[model samples]
Target: MLGIVLPAIITAFSLLILDWLLPGITIDTVTASVLAAVSIGIVNGVVKPIIQLLSLPLTFVTFGLFSLLVNGFCLWLSSAFVPGFEVRGLVGFLVGPIALSFLSTTFGHYLLEGRTPASLPEA
Candidate 1:
């Protein structure tokens, strides 16, 4: 389906972009990037919400800044399951996810602009 495939491709492409920009982030091959992308999506979808729920108090105490740790943990955990994809150090842990988020948003917006329902003509 376009819905699933599009986001996965975007995530993979965003990982490749991060690999290029961040020294601490290394994706050995295109396959690794794609695998990592799927892994990240799965982790974010399944694990992130539980972690977020558990960390609700901290998240509130930190004024939502605690989400950085949750996001970074999800990224790191996903990397552990995928070979040839490595996120190293604090920069990779924190900044990699941050950069990935930004790149994914920007790329997805431009690439998916015309595909959105708002662009469809009224029936």
Candidate 2:
């Protein structure tokens, strides 16, 4: 779906912001960006549900903090798939994905689908 794929692509660019905002994480180029996006989407798609299912109790117990770990795992998994994208160590591994989740949530909420809150049909 274009809805999903395009947001994932945009998320790759958001990685640029994450790297800038934090440190020790890098995605070197458009190629790496695209690869990271696609790989992350695939990783999230295939792995996230399973992780969520397995961690459901923890998710409930922590009031969703474990979701951050799942997010970080997806980023670490993307690092495995993309050559030029790297998360240097544990700190970056933990912070990078959570930061990325924030960036993607902000950007995707405002930018993607070409519709703002003012333009949407009323509930």
Candidate 3:
């Protein structure tokens, strides 16, 4: 489905960019990037919700900013399962997810716009 595949691709692109931009985030190859992207997608889909729920009070106290930390944790967790996808140190753990989130969101919005029904006017 486009819904799933598109996000994965976007995440991969984001990872590639992060690999280039950040010294702490190292993706060894294109294959590694794709694998990391898929791993991150899975983590975000499955694990992130549980984390959000468990940290609901903290999220509320932080006025939803704690969700960013949750995202970073998910990214760090994905790196552990993905070979050749290394996130070094605390900085990588924190910034990688935020960068990936921004890139994926931007690319998904731009790329999927034409495929979405909202792009079409009512009959």
Candidate 4:
């Protein structure tokens, strides 16, 4: 779907930028970026639901704030297997989701979707 692929590309590029900006985080090439993106999608699709289900009580107790930890864990897990994509230490791992989300949203709005429609015609 256009929605999914667009955001994925944004996340991949954001990871690349983060690697350049942040030491100990490295996304070496475009190939690595693609791999990291795919791995992230798989982890989010397959692992996240199970994690959320298991952590439901904690999620409720923390007012859903602990969900961020799950996102961080998934990011770390995806990075572990992807070559040339390395996120060292807790800072990179924890901030990964936030950075990706921010970048993806910005990129999606500005570059991918190309601004909101000014008007809609009647069907």
Candidate 5:
């Protein structure tokens, strides 16, 4: 439960940050941000695998980098369904996913996973 819920909340926070930093991403309200975050998680879990299977050839050709485009498309699709959340233009589609990925990874590693400087052994 914590594993699933925590990541979703973290993703919401990342979305909020992205909304603040990027003009292309708009999250109108707190409720919308939460909805959008859940939507993205659903899309990633349900839709992404199907898309990946279909795009396997392209993914292979691109050395797996094409997965990023798939991820961006999922984020864009979630925005379309959420009224107050909007990702505008091609730049938004591209940057939104990348920024979300970066923030989510950082949050998961350092925050959610409970890794801290004090926990590390000194060399």
Candidate 6:
């Protein structure tokens, strides 16, 4: 449970980056951004798998490219739940989520590399 916290926080920061990087996406407040991140996590954890399973045939037909739409759908669904967070148009629907994932992973990697339990204990 505690382990999940860092990734979620990282994701919120990544969303803030996305807000800066993409014009089609809007996150008005930090609190809204965090809520949007949590909403995205919930959608990914609870809804996306089911959608993936249902869309498996389409995914197979498209050689997995269709998974991008699925990912976009998840991000769109997440935005709907958080006030002041909006993902609009094709770029927001398609590219925003991919960027967010990349930013979150990169940030998480660098952050984790800098702070291990051993390093923390020393500091």
The per-prediction CA RMSD against the true structure, in angstroms, equals 3.0, 4.5, 3.8, 4.4, 5.5, 3.1
- Model 2: how far residue 113 lies from native, Å: 6.3
For residues 1-123, what per-residue lDDT tens digits would candidate 5 score against the true structure?
Answer: 556667788899999999999888999998899999999999999999999999999999999999988988999999989999999877678888999999989987877467444554445
Each model's TM-score? 0.92, 0.79, 0.86, 0.83, 0.86, 0.90
- Tell me the deviation in Å of residue 93 in model 5: 0.8
- Highest-TM-score candidate: 1
RMSD (CA, angstroms), candidate 1? 3.0
Return the candidate ranking by TM-score, descending.
1, 6, 5, 3, 4, 2
Clashing pairs in 5: none
Query: Which parts of model 3 are misplaced by more than 4 Å?
Result: 117-123
- The better-scoring model by lDDT among 2 and 6 is 6
Q: Rank candidates, lDDT, best first.
A: 1, 6, 5, 3, 4, 2
Candidate 6 wrong stretches, greater than 4 Å: 114-123
Error of 2 at 71 (Å): 1.2
9-102 in candidate 1: lDDT tens per residue? 9999999989999988999999999999999999999999999999999999999999999999999999999999999999899999999999
Writing each residue's lDDT as its tens digit, candidate 3 over 1-123 gives: 556666788889889998999877999999999999999879988999999999999999999999878988888899999999998877787887887778888988898775664444444
Model 3's number of clashes is 0
Query: Positional deviation of 119 in candidate 3, in angstroms?
Result: 9.6
Alpha carbon lDDT of each predicted model: 0.91, 0.80, 0.85, 0.81, 0.88, 0.90
Give me the runs in candidate 1 sitting further than 4 Å from their true place: 117-123
Extract clashing residue pairs from model 2: none
Candidate 5, which segments miss by more than 4 Å at Cα? 114-123
lDDT of 2 by residue, 8-33 (tens): 66788888777677775888887888
| TM-score: model 4 vs. ground truth | 0.83
The lDDT, on a scale of 0 to 1, for candidate 2 is 0.80
